[model samples]
Structures are given as structure tokens and as C-alpha cells.
Target: MTQAQTLDHTSDQSIEHRIGTAVNQNAAHTREGLLERLFGWFFKGLVYAQIWEDPVADMNALQITEQDDLVCIASGGCNVMSYLMAQPASITAVDLSPAHVALNKLKVAAPRYLDQNAFYDLFGHANKDSNIRALDQHVLPHLDQITRAYWNKATWRGQRKQMFARGLYRHGLLGQFLKFAHALCWAGGVKFDKLLTAQSLDDQNAFFDQEIAPLYDSRFVRFLANRRASLFGLGIPPAQYDKLAADTGGDIIAVLRERTRKLFCDFPIHDNYFAWQAANRGYKSDGTGPVPPYLEAQNFETLRACVDRVEVLNQSVTEMLAAQPEGSKSVYVLLDAQDWMNDDQLNDLWHQITRTARPGARVLFRTGGLTDILPGRVEGAILNHWRYDAEASTRATAEDRSAIYGAVHMYRYEGA
Candidate 1:
């Protein structure tokens, strides 16, 4: 062959090789991005939408006092009981979930009426035998026939009187949702096993960014973007999904990435057990480090002392606020509840907050994104008087992992 022809042939082969490499890289990036999106979609659908209860953050954020009468959205009743540990005068707990109502009732009665040792064994330890014993000995006898029957009816494959028997402590809808997501992670080639074994925050963060972030960038998550019905399991109705998606610009990945990055990065992973629950279905059996406040040894006595102050109600904030006397409550905690409301509901709730405000009443809640709740929803006349400490809210959120709330806000009503 001629020398010029040989040179041209070699150059052509090099160009083809470069083109193939570029094509391969692009394909890998697209494939990875699609899977990450799927993880976000299904994760949001089955987990956050259906059965998440942010008890740890909610209780820890507000310093409840014996003199304080409080109102809260009692999603699962865990936080209400936790707050009662603070010895609040009264906790008017409300929820739209009937299932949640039944669950909360059990919690309220368990601590108030159960023997201290039994209560500790049942909830503090969350042992199956002790849970059943406590239910039979204390809780069952005190609950109304209606609620009692409800608990008696719901049974798992291996358990009877399911609410009374507590083996599946982490097998709620939320737990199952996480389990499913974890399985998906394995299937997607992102190894998350280290999360279970991470000895330090640095290890946890590295595992999350290196292993989990890639999972967020997958195809399965992108597919989830279109399936609203599948998300009902996560307790997100169609309407809320539209709003959440719209608010986050239809990219649930970015929303989750930003919010969860704070949880994984800002605090010591050990200190934030809720984050552990989020990443790993349950906490490590041996208490090598900090546990949830409700599970902490020191706080059990406090929890026992004032368990009766919390009463769970199956109603909306408007209904509960209406039922309470004006100035009856000194504190109001609404955790991401506003995300579920429309404009009218928002206005009505704030009006109740205004009327229910004692001289120095305070209100705390979370928002889906970083915006303050008052600006568009509550009237300026009422909103302007109350103080909005954005910095304090940011600080509180940074410290709390169960706080998926883009904003953890507090408003104090300094009414004359």
C-alpha cells in the first residue's frame, strides 16, 4: 500500500474508536440517570406518600412544658406521646387517617394506663411478648370497644390481635416501602450494605454519595414520574403528587437529593436515628450510640409521667381548632400538614391559630420546599405581626433527619 493511504487508514481507525467510546459513555450516563429517577419516583410513591411519621423531629423541635397546652397533627401518634414526655398540659392530636387514629389511640392508652414496667417492655423495648402482654393487661381493657375491635381485626400472617402483638415493629407500610426500595438498590447494582455497618458519619456520607446517589440517577425512578396510582401506597393522593411534582419542577430526584443530602451530610448519622431508619429499616440492636428520644433510657420516666395528656383525634386541624376553646392551647405543631391543604384550609387554620394564641403562643410546622408558609396563604395583616426566624428554622432542620421538610418554621403570636 502507498504511505499516504496507510496514514489515512490509521487515522480513520482512531476516529472510529473515539466515536465508539463517546457513544458508550453517553449510553451509561443516560442509563444511570434513568434508574436514579426511578428510585426517587417509587421511593417517594411507596414510602413518603403512604406511611411516614416524623415523630423524632417533631417532638425534639418543640420544648413542651407542663403549662403548655398543645395541638398537633397526630399522624401516627408517636410524636404526641413523645411530647407528653415533656409533660404538656394537654395534647389535642388530630389526623385524617382512620388507620392512624386507631394506632394513636393505642399509644395514648398504652402509656397512660399501662404499668410502667409493662409500658417500657412494650414500647421502649418493643418486644413482641411484652407488647401483647401490655395490650392484654392494660391497653385492651381501657380502649373503647370500637377501637379495641379494630385492633383485634387487623392481623399479620404470624400474629393475631396485630396491634396488641408487636413483632412487626418496623413492618408498617413505611417499613415495607423501605424494604422494597432496598431490594431495588441491590438489583440496580448500587451496594448499600455499608449503610447498615457504617461506623461513622464519614462512612455513611461516602456510601450515600458513592452508592446511593447513582441509584437516584436510574431509569426506574424516571418511569415512576408518570405513575401516580403506584404512589398512593406512600399516602400521596393524586392531587398532592401533582403539587409536589410541580413544586419541585417534576424532577423528584432534585427534590429528594437536596433534602436528603442535608440528612446524610449535616449531622452525625448516629445522633439522627430517624435517618438510620430511612436508610436502614431499623436501628442496630446494640445501642452503640444515640437512639431516638422515645427510645432513650432517660426519657422513659418522663414519657410515663404524662402519657395521659395526649389524646388522639381523627379530624382536621380546622375541626380540632374549632373544638378547642379560644386561647386553650399555647403551642401548635403542624408537620407538613399544610402541604395537604388548599388555600381555604390554610386560611382557616391560621385564623384558628390566631384565636387560639395565648399571649405568647407559638406554632411550628414544616413545608415541602424552602418557602415560608405565611406569605401566600395567610393574610399579610395577621402574618406580619408574627415573627419568622428563617435562620433558626434552617438550624433546626439541619439538626433533624426525619425533617424532610424543606422548611422547619416557627411563628410566635405575641398578642396583647
Candidate 2:
């Protein structure tokens, strides 16, 4: 079957089956190591409703234009919506997780139909009671049947719609992980919320120095940081775990401490939503806080106008690109998914990427390690077709406000 046909034929059962297949595929390529297996299992259960990477850095590196057709891995669906503001010709958002596919569809569809306040309440002020009601009245009727079914499915707490009522950010894998981190901080007498009170960069640095940095020194924190399972919260697969350790001289604690410090101290808290989410366990409750670019009121009308340009699919990126016509896409956002792949997988993906990309197409991605993996791993023949923009990549990495990833890499396809 054609790639689009295969994706279109994926019933809800098939999507679940695909998730299982993907987990197995990831595990099978990783030598079936115990930690790899554990990570694969963890990934299968993870529902990433919010993306962690900085989309602003991604867009800056991509230099997206109205003529560019883009394909991105839809994680939390945040960046997919954010990308709409750039007015790309088309955005094909593919994800193996059915939950993410549904969420992305919901995001794209919500803006098209819902009024401003209702849309904000559903996604921005996710803790509010009206979110579920808004989802029902304004959003559900507009979604495709599969997406609607996915959202309406029951969870342990209640229907998935109730997730917004309970606070959408508190439900996903990353969200729950942050919640656990906050719980740990509270137990240890460190108030993560206090980091939000810092009025300046120096104050933020001092807050981290006095309150957050010391938490990493505790035996309990050190022990947790050392465990592979502990990092599943951050969506670190077993392979990425090894890369992170190797990059940090096997000192995961030190690496995490440094990254956490950068997150808190390097950016102004007023505009760094990532730090706010990490510290406060959600976006600022007042709705005036820093948020994803799409959620900002200024971009709402533009995003709403561009909603129809996006397509959400439950499929793999390689498959989606393989199905496209040559020179079909100009921008690719891999979002650290490459770190999970073996060399063969990477080569296969790059092969399809090169085939589908137009000349001057820009590819943006992050890595668990500071070094470039593509140079040695992807076949030289395929790698030669793309020029790695090392200087731009370095600038993008340094400017990335999220400050969690080890490096951000960008490449420009030079054509056949």
C-alpha cells in the first residue's frame, strides 16, 4: 500500500497495534538490552501532550516561509500549532502515539472553530472548568471521526475530555514527571514555585544556587538521577541515556544539575514558559504568563486562519516522507526522535528525507549528546547531499531557551 493509504487505513485498533509494533521495533534494534526494553515499554505508555523543546529556536533555524512545506514529529502538539504562525504552505504532523495524533488534531481544529476565550481556556488556562465544555461545544464537532473517538475514549479518571478539567498539563508523561519532581522538591523542603518569584536573571541564578542547586547534592536526588527509569519522565530513551552519560563523563547527576541550572538562571522567568512549567508544574495560572507562541493572543487569528494547512497523522516520519513526491517538503523538524534510532534507522530516514526534500530545504533537530551523530552514522552518500550548517547550528543551540538539550543541529539539502 502507499504510505498515505496505509496511514488512512489505520483504524483505532491499528493505531494501538502500531504503537506496540513501534515499541517492539525500537527494542529489537537496540540489542534487546534490559534497559532498552524497559525504555521501550515506558515510551509506549507515555502521552506527550506538551512539547519540551523550544519552537522559537527551531523556527529561527528553519527560517520558514509561506512557500515551505514542513513535516514534524507531533509530540505534545504545541510546536505543530506554533509552526502555523510562520504560514508554511503545509504541515504534515506525524506521530506513532495515537494520543499525540489526537492532540495535534485537536489543537489544529480547536483554533479553527472555537472562539478566543474558549480556545484559550481549553489550551492555555487548561485548569479551568470551562475547557471540557468548550471542547464539547466548539471543538468536537469539527474534528475528524478518528480524532473525536480518540479524545472521547475513557481513561482511568474519566473520559479523556476530563483531562482538561483536571489540568491538561498535569496528565501527560512530561507533565506527570514534573509533578513528581515538584512533589520531591516539596518533600525535601525546596519550594520550586519560589523560583518564579525571582525578578531578574541574577535573582533567578541566586534562587537556583540557594534553593534548586542544593537539591541535586542530596543522596536521594543523586540516586534518582542515576537511574534510567528516573529519566523516562524527560522522555530519555535508553540509547539517549547512554549518549547523555557519555557526553557528561558518565555523570548524569552533574549533567542534569547543569541543565537545570541553565534552565532557571540563563533566561528571564517572565518570558521563559519552560522554566515556569518545570517549576510551577503548569503554565502561570493567571493566563498572562509566558506560553507557546500559538497560545499567545497576538498569533491567534493568524493561527486560526492557517489551521486548515495542517494535517495530523498517526504514522512514522520516514514513512510519511517516503510517501511524498520528490521536492515536496522544505522544512523538517525531527525533535530528538533521531537519538532513539540505530545507524540503519538513521540512514533509512535520511535517505527518505533527502528524496523528499527540495533544494535548500532545512532540517532541524536536537541530540542527546553534544556531537553530531549524522556524520558518522548516516551513509556518506546520503550525508553528502546535505550541507550541515555548523555555525548556524551552534548559534541555535546557544540561543535555545529551553536549555535542556545538549545540542541543536541544522542541515540544508543542496539538491541532487
Best by lDDT: 2
Give candidate 1's error at residue 397 in angstroms.
1.9
* Alpha-carbon local distance difference test for all models: 0.63, 0.84
- Backbone clashes in candidate 2 total 1
State, as a TM-score between 0 and 1, how close model 2 is to the true structure: 0.93
Residue 387 in candidate 1, Cα distance off native in Å? 2.4
- What TM-scores do the predictions have? 0.79, 0.93
Show model 2 residue runs off by greater than 4 Å. Answer: 1-32
> Taking the tens digit of each residue's C-alpha lDDT, what string does model 1 give over 1-416?
89767864774465344323212222336753343334333321113211244555555555667899988877655567667667778888876555566677776676567665566556444535667766877688888865676566634454334423443345555656567776777787765467666778788789778877776678887576467554444444444455556667787667666666666666666676666666655554454544445556677677777776777775667777887777778888887767655566677888888877787787888766567756878887667657775665666666556656566787777674
Weakest lDDT window of 10 consecutive positions for candidate 1: 42-51
Candidate 2 lDDT (Cα, 0 to 1): 0.84
Off by over 4 Å in 1: 1-61, 112-121, 124-130, 154-160, 163-169, 230-233, 239-248, 287-290
The true-versus-predicted C-alpha distance at residue 124 of model 2, in Å, is: 0.7
